[model samples]
Target: MPAKKTKPTWTDVKKNLASFDNPGLIALLHDLYTASKDNQAFLHTRFGLGDDVLKPYKATLTRWLWPNWLKNQNTSVTTAKKAIADYKKAVGQPDGLAELMVFYCEQAAAFSSDVGLDDESYYDALVRMFEQALKTIAALPEQQRPALWTRLDQVRRLGHQVGYGISTSMDELLIEYGVDARRSR
Candidate 1:
């Protein structure tokens, strides 16, 4: 009887490639990209070769922050959550996720005033954005984390003036993040 053949796993392939030289690695990548459309697309997006690298992400934030017709609190919260997840999947990896979260905070801030929205519902939605951002800061590099926190502090100050900062949870989150909620300025 013939012996069973095991399929080649990614671990096996990675081990084999451990001895690859620069040119060999490049050649292997080129071959892999050529062999699979998925590989090509991944390389394009992953290496910033694709145009509109941040287009979809920008659009996602815009849609929630500034809806085409009217601003909806529920939609904003849902969209912001989805945008955070999308950012994690597409851009956030080892170092740059904070930028995306900060961008979301900015959008949420602008979103507060743009539609003349200053109610608790909308503010709560905005707070949700801040919460997600705060949660993500731990994953960011030390150099990047403070900048995001600074932006978030600014948002908290502004949101407080506008009524979104009324959420006790928001204040708690600020303290939890080691932010001086009293000196948001």
Candidate 2:
């Protein structure tokens, strides 16, 4: 009988990597850096090498969340959210994560408002990310909180323009976070 074939795992790859010397590892890293834009972004973010490490991640978010409908582009919340997850995995800086989350909320809300998207699932995802942005921003330092809050406040206004009770949901979240919805308006 033929032997069964199995998928290779990270452990298998790591075991293989255990044999490499420093120069070999550097060569492998160079190969990875040149292999793909994603690899380059990950390496840049991991080492804090770029002038704006978040730029690639933001571009991914913009592409997935706020696509150009005239060009037949489609939105993918999963892909947009994956960019945030990828950034988190690269460094998980709290302020950076908050920025990306707020930016995610902003892109999604703006798209919904502009397109008049009537998808229930999309609104649900937007509201969820709104709440998440609030949570993440709330955990940041008091000084850091203001700018993110202002951005989310803009998102809340966009939600109102979206016209699916998204603004109401965001208002409730703002109240829960002690932001005073009436004051935020």
Best by TM-score: 2
Residue-level lDDT of model 1, residues 9-97, one tens digit each, is 99998999999999999999899889965455446557777675555566677777666653333446676567556656644564445
The number of the candidate with the highest lDDT is 2
lDDT of 2 by residue, 128-157 (tens): 988888899888887778778878989899
Model 2: which residue pairs collide? none
If candidate 1 were superposed on the true structure by all CA atoms, what would the RMSD be? 6.9
RMSD of each: 6.9, 1.9
Note the Cα lDDT for every prediction shown.
0.66, 0.89
- TM-score for all models, in order of appearance: 0.59, 0.92
In candidate 1, stretches whose alpha carbon ends up further than 4 angstroms from where it belongs are 1-44, 50-52, 68-75, 118-121, 164-168, 180-185
For each predicted model, how many residue pairs clash, with residues at least 3 apart or on different chains?
Answer: 0, 0
TM-score of 2: 0.92
